[model samples]
Target: MRHLFTIALVSLLLAPPAQAQNDVRFQVLGGDEALRDALIAASRLQAVTDEEDSASQDIVAAARSDYARLLAVLYEQGYFGPDISITLNGREVAGMSPFDRITQVRSAAITVEPGRAFRLGRAVIAPLAPGTDLPEGFRSGAPAGTVILRETTEAGIMGWRTQGHATADVGNQQITARHNEAELDAEITLAPGPVYRFGTLIPRGEERMRTRRVLRIAGLPTGEVYDPDEVDRAADRLRDTGVFTSVGFTEIPNPDGTLDVQAELVEAPLRRVGFGAEIQSQDGLTVSGYWLHRNLFGGAERLRFDAEISDIGAQNSGIDGFVSGLFSRPADLTPDTTLELGFRIEHLDEPTFVEDTASINIGLEHQFSDELTATAGVFARYSDVSDNFSERSVWMVGLPLGLTWDSRDNAFDAASGWYADATLTPFTAFEDGGGVRATADLRAYYGFGEEDSTRLAGRLQLGTVDGGDIAALPPDWLFYSGGSGTVRGQDHQSLGAMQNGVQTGGRSFAGASFEIRQDLFGNFGAVAFYDVGYVSEGAYGEGASDWHSGAGLGLRYDTPIGPIRLDIATPVSGDGTGEDVHLYLGIGQNF
Candidate 1:
């Protein structure tokens, strides 16, 4: 009971402020959900908005300030005609005793009478640009509010500007309220100047990265009709490159009825190095590091090298080491395309296999839009492997195609977003036999409440190998489960197709995970999660297969980089069982 009470208290405190500890009891009487919530949110009823001492005079002063603030809030909610009263200890604040004499404090009451919400009687905006789509509520008999009026005005002006009018303004405005009829009438007009064409790209104040590279990256549609959105997109492109500390675009009128765009850039550091690590109770430890040269080849080219070592524990000496180097040149093809070349080497020692491999891959990735990207590559690899029973050597080449769609607000810690990716690789064996493999993954996040204090996240993954013989396929082409990204409570890569009691890779795989996250305190959070994984020797679940499930709890400490995560879990059901629980420590959300 005590623990339950403590948890309850903490939860209440974490919620966006109604907390007064039974002191200064606050209430709003007689109002709809929207009106009551808005009034409380913008008034002293909220802990953040309460800025006065507990004394009666200070409290009364704060209460008085709420009158205007909440009035404006209601006006935006279409409650143009309102009667609001504030009282302290059941006595009207207007009739309270002098602050010098009144010392006692008790309860506060806010009552709102939003009599007969107002609606638009007539909404007239003249000279609207073609293709203007304003707020849906900007019409006769619709809800009348300040927000609608402001949005309608901005939309009209933006619509004109989008049609090549570089200069657009609100030329006139008239607003009136009919108190007897509970109605409002709004009249506005927009003034749009003549259209203008885009002139040449003018580079300004760019160093280190070169002006031509900046122009190529910006990809502004020069010699086309002037559009503000194009300038914004150009700025976005420059910022996304990470080579610039700051980026901006400015417009200037030319004598030839054209608008010239000037690109401004501030250079960023060219070199950066970073390191991170993760530890798991059952899986041992993993450490990784990377170094990047942002503009090594001068045309926004990037050269990167990274390495990692995993599994440093007593029960096993089969540690794993991996290293890779990659070089990418942006805008080498089209404006939204990048060319990449990479090489990698892996050294592995596991219960089932001890192997080493070296590989190289070359790819071209194109950005179709902000949310979509596609890439195709060719890869070659050679490997030597020795299992507990025998040894084998093989080499292969393959063509890989991949597509991704990302709408997440934050890649590492998302609150309301979705991401999906798919990859297909087809290889022809030089020594053994080859096949085609395909995999796909999807993840989504959703949040609730005003502050998004509660979040739900989910993920699904699937994999298959269609052509290669089971023994001839590259070990890396197969799939396994029971890791941080799969069934967390189980040992890493512990669940797979079994051969003579040895866990080997599988040709088909599926995994699902779900989590519910709750905020506990500032920058602190907790989660309840469930994960399940399935792997089989058959491509379509035809051969031997197994299923595993795990449930867990996690703690998160938010940071600028991402979230520091600590998870503890146990297997609910699985094919392999060796440990009662597993603990994982890492950075970033598990997807």
Candidate 2:
């Protein structure tokens, strides 16, 4: 007969009865402090005995069930033999019958005597798959904890399953305890049913999305060896399209040594609309809204239109507005590729220039992995400009190439990981010669302390426009500093390069920012930040340049979508130089 005890899952807390009270006192003998605490926590009597309305029958039931629960806890800690006793009002709970229940209960006592800890005499598992790694403590002469035995067996089973064995499981397990020698012997065997291949992918529960598009988006590998990782990746690809409210996969075994995958999906609503607003002391107010259609033609194509107005009630600049539209189709050329068509018309009124522009772009974005993507687009644009320079109408053609890598924990409020984006655009003008513009944004975050209560984040931004004079290019394509997005404490576009005694957006720019955030209490947090910016008339900070710095403190309130942010800052160096304070309100982190 097996000497080891069998463990079963049991609910630790029982519902309290009304109109009765009972006190529970627990003790553990012949055990260390850690063992005593574990036994008390595992006992059901200790979980609910303090309830003010616990009935006598409820208390008795809890005390009776605690024997198995406490024994299981002891076995996990290498204690093979344990003596457990429970009494109600000095009467043994084990001897009482359910039919003979007392009307009221006063007090209950639980005592546990954990015997000597055991060590493994022999631990073995046969025929493990290649590259299977078991727990470090699963070797002979180590502490004979039941958790180690369970983990060792699970690792063995999962190893075979990764090698195209879909039905791998435990064949047999033997666990024996020798009380006299304080030793345990554990042996396990795994059953790898068969090597299977992928048969077909079937979609279910989809109402609006076409079945062919679903297959294209998922791109499940048929006629290939069944891989659990591939199955999971297919599910992730479906979810990333944002057309499904819920997505899941099920495996069906076939008689012909193949596995059929069933994709269950719940399609989301076709249309969505949302709006957002942000305000800064100098930059003024920006309000934007978007409308999106998830399944425009029943093939998971997304059509979206966006509009924005900025510089409302500002002291420095006139109002600016734009309307833009984008059409995107997934799996256009490859399973990971998306085709994009975009159109935009905009009017800009700034301190140094006023312009109207219209543009159209066609592009392809390819997702190389979950964290990396590359894009290439060709655009045609027309712009009419009026500035200190002569007014002119310019027509241009450009090619934009970009790459992005993001692994942040949260895009809105990241606690860890890195994000980087780089874009380079080359253009040819109808009247003037061609030039190239390049920009990059990089950010990193690290979290420490309990539950990531503290985070340190940093960002770097760089921009340069080369192969043309500063006055020859579109003013909006140039760079400006001293705003909420750069140096928060200074006026919007206040710092720029000087050419011909006139201040204008820079040909080169560089900025760096850092913040330390700490959780204060509840959903509230505090942050301290420092920012520095530089601009020059020549590319790559070559010609005359100026530097400015700002420092501030902010507060944050967490929400489901993101965090509500409020910041107050002032200039610390260069122009303004600690003279004025600026306030900003927005959603999500400053980055």
Worst 10 residues of 2 by lDDT: 4-13
Q: What local distance difference test score does each model get?
A: 0.82, 0.88
Task: Show the lowest summed lDDT stretch of 10 residues, model 1.
Answer: 15-24
Give the alpha carbon lDDT tens digit for every residue of 216-246 in model 1.
9888888899899888877877787788888
Candidate 2 lDDT over residue span 510-536, tens digit each: 999999999999999999999999999
Looking at model 1, residue 525 earns an lDDT score of 95
Q: What is the C-alpha RMSD of each candidate to the true structure, in Å?
A: 9.4, 6.3
- Structural similarity to truth (TM-score) of each candidate: 0.84, 0.87
Show where candidate 2 strays beyond 4 Å. 1-121, 133-151, 177-185
TM-score of 1: 0.84
Cα error of candidate 2 at position 401, Å: 1.8
How much does candidate 2 score in TM-score?
0.87
